[model samples]
Target: MPVTLRPLRVAAAQAESVAGDLDANVATAVHLVSAAADWGARVVVLPELFLTGYSPQAWLPELTTTPDDPRLEPLASAARERAVVVVAGAAVRRSGPDGSAQRFTLSLLVVDEAGEVTAPYDKQHLFDTERAFFAPGAQGASIVVDGWELGLGVCYDGCFPEHARAAAEDGARAYLCPSAYVAGSEHRRDLYYAARALDNGIYVVFAGLTGRCGGLDFSGGSAVYDPEGRALGRAGIISPAAVVADLDPVEVARVQAENPIARDRLGSLGGRSRVVVAGPRP
Candidate 1:
């Protein structure tokens, strides 16, 4: 007889964030985290800029804050009490060097079961409109938990294959995307998300913001996909919801063994594709 490993239960949350309201947004995230935990999720993902709302055109500067801000304590407490990994989004302010202006980054903060907060993983690729208000992050990031390497990506970052590919090369078993995508872009999600999973043979979890926030209407298509690019669960386009799925390492192993794309690429592509070292994790 052999000891078996339990499948990892992950949850993707689709919720609305009120612009410029930190306390309210944190409360919402806490509630969602609790709900996900109650459903036995070991990892819970929220949408992009969920803490301050996805206000790219207005009120960005006012909503930006350092990763250590006390306002985020409630989320940390939730993660600690629930014993789950919470990945939430926010705009992080980083001071520039040598008297340069402060730079704001669209970032994801990872909270572990011990209530520890890791360094922020900023969005490497800024959307067209986002460039005006946010600076692009320098490096990608991933965290290892319960024998799984989970990669982090913001909304626009998922559009670029290299972003997710880099994480896959660095040993990520699953990719988590936090997005604030708008309506009328269903094709984008349908195409790219599946490709990302199929191309790398890694699980992909997407959490999108829903409802109208400010002047933008979000396309709430939160979903989780297996390594074979099969959707395990999905949420609606106009409602606040959550989708959860149990991802088995055995399934990932079976897919990778059958496909071997990542392994075969190493021989044919030479050095064109290389492992990207992610930023430090908690």
Candidate 2:
């Protein structure tokens, strides 16, 4: 018998984070996750560093937490109660090589419906300003939910085609970018995200932080794109919002079969290339 592909309802949330407030931010994330679940979203993605405002300058150290921190339990509980996958951001602390001083990395925490949290997926690409505080992650990361492979990326990572390409090569049918882009940049970012989807033949979901944080206003253009690079759903750039869309794996398969960009690369290059690690995934 042939297999059937089910549609996966996914959501992207655009909201501001309170700087240096873990409890309040976690509460907000839980609320957003619950709201998405209410809307029948199987997977809800929040903005980058939503748990601790995207203030890399001052709040980086203040907001850093270990993966097993007790404060994160509320999010896990909410995921279990909603029976949905919750992806949120935070600063994760890890010891340096050979037990050196602790280092922080911008990361996403994936909480399953069973309340089990996966290891932190760090952001490999750092924006110019972010490098001063957080260390870059080591590799790319993806999670399989309901037999769908969903890849993860942070703000600036979405700007790099190689980042999404690496995930696509790793069998990701969709790429989720949790970002904190400032106001006035939404238009360019939207085009970039669409191109990423078109080039990879995979769904692209962008969740951006909105409102003001640390004296900077954010652009809230949260959106979901289909494999054809069409906007399935999108939120405005002015306020906190959520965009939900259904992703069908069958559509991805159909697009890949028709376009064949992912598979045609080697033959197009005359089979003279070898793959190399573009960057790190944590």
TM-score of each: 0.89, 0.90
Badly placed stretches (over 4 Å) of model 2 are 1-4, 96-100, 266-282
Give candidate 1's whole-model lDDT. 0.86
Query: Any idea what lDDT model 2 has?
Result: 0.87
Record all residue pairs in model 1 with backbone atoms less than 3 Å apart, i.e. clashing: none
Q: Given candidate 1, what's the lDDT at residue 105?
A: 84
lDDT of 1 by residue, 1-282 (tens): 755656889999978888878898899999999999999999999999888788765446667877678988999999999999999888887876875678888889888999887655999888887888888899989987787888989988888888889999998989999998888987897678878999899999999998877788888889999998988888977455789999888888899999998778754534566686997789
Global lDDT scores for all candidate models: 0.86, 0.87
Q: How much does candidate 1 score in TM-score?
A: 0.89
